[model samples]
Every structure is written in C-alpha cells, then in structure tokens.
Target: MERDKGKLELIATQRVNANSEMYKVVDFLNKSLKNYHLMFGLTKKDESMVISIYEVE
Candidate 1:
C-alpha cells in the first residue's frame, strides 16, 4: 500500500491534515475533487484510505 500512500500524498499535496481521520480526508477530497474535471474511486481499508482518479468524459 505504499503506492496508494504516494497517490494520496500527490493528490493532497500541502493540504493534508496530520490530525484528521482518514475518513474525513476522504470526504474532503471527495467534495473538492468533484469540482474538477476528474472522477475519484475511494476505498476504505480499516482506518486507511485509497483514492483513484480518472478523467471526466
């Protein structure tokens, strides 16, 4: 899951909150990403999160 962490890091950039729960981060990313020309695939693994992005059609 190291690759998934990298993906989240790239996506979140400097906006990541160190104290927030993974679910909260996922929710925030979900709303913010919806405003762009991209779509996201989110999966929760216990207390961690995995995000996948795809171009909008």
Candidate 2:
C-alpha cells in the first residue's frame, strides 16, 4: 500500500510538472500569436494573445 501511494504521488508530481510546462508553452504561443496579430492589424486589444483567432472572430 505504501508503494502504491508512492507511485501515485510520483504520477501526480509528474502531471503537475507537465502542466507547468504546458502552461509555459501556452504563454509562449500566446505571445507569438499576439505579435502576429499586431503585425497583421487583426487585433487592437493588447490583452488578446495565444487564443484561437476563430474564437475572437
């Protein structure tokens, strides 16, 4: 039972780490997308970034 708990903890930690990395990727992508939109004059709001263009439309 202790071993199983340890494994579960490890899995949860890994998932949190993965989620952190994913969030970082999302931030980077959002910054890039915002830049692209600014270059194209597609968005005027400074808050818009990283989200899908279709969603904005």
Candidate 3:
C-alpha cells in the first residue's frame, strides 16, 4: 500500500543520515589523530575511558 511505501522511504532516509553522520565522525577522529601524533588504547579502569596520548610537535 502507499502507506507502507512511505514508511520504507522514511526508513531509508534515516539510514542515509545515520551513515553520513558516522562518516563525519570517523573523518574527524582520523584528522585529529594525524594532526596530534596521538596514540589511543583501552584503559583498565573502565571500558568507556579510552586513553589518548598526544605529544606536541
């Protein structure tokens, strides 16, 4: 039905937006890592606290 088609289109558009946001986040992280000579690793204290070290160049 036309209603189903509309729902599918909305879902597709949402997926596209999510993918675009993911790409932007990845790009930003990559640029920051490169610009700062940064190193990142998982911390033992907690799973969420990722440790990132950067040295001034």
List the candidate numbers ranked by TM-score, top first.
Answer: 1, 2, 3
Backbone clash count, each prediction separately: 0, 1, 0
What would the per-residue lDDT of candidate 3 be over residues 1-57, giving only the tens digit for each residue? 234321211111111222324445545665767555443322333223333333333
Query: In candidate 2, which residue ranges exceed 4 Å CA deviation?
Result: 1-18, 36-55
User: Least accurate stretch of 10 residues (summed lDDT) in model 1?
Assistant: 5-14
Model 1 Cα lDDT, one tens digit per residue, 1-57: 234322322332222223446556566766887666454555655555566555553
Off by over 4 Å in 1: 1-20, 45-49
Best by lDDT: 1
Give the top-scoring candidate (TM-score): 1
Better model by TM-score, 1 or 2?
A: 1
25 Cα displacement, candidate 1 (Å):
1.1
| Residue-level lDDT tens digits of model 2 in 1-57 | 233321211111111222324556555655776534321112123433322222121
How displaced is residue 2 in candidate 3, in Å? 63
- Overlapping backbone residue pairs in candidate 2 total 1
Model 3 error, position 20 (Å): 2.1
Clashing pairs in 2: 30-50
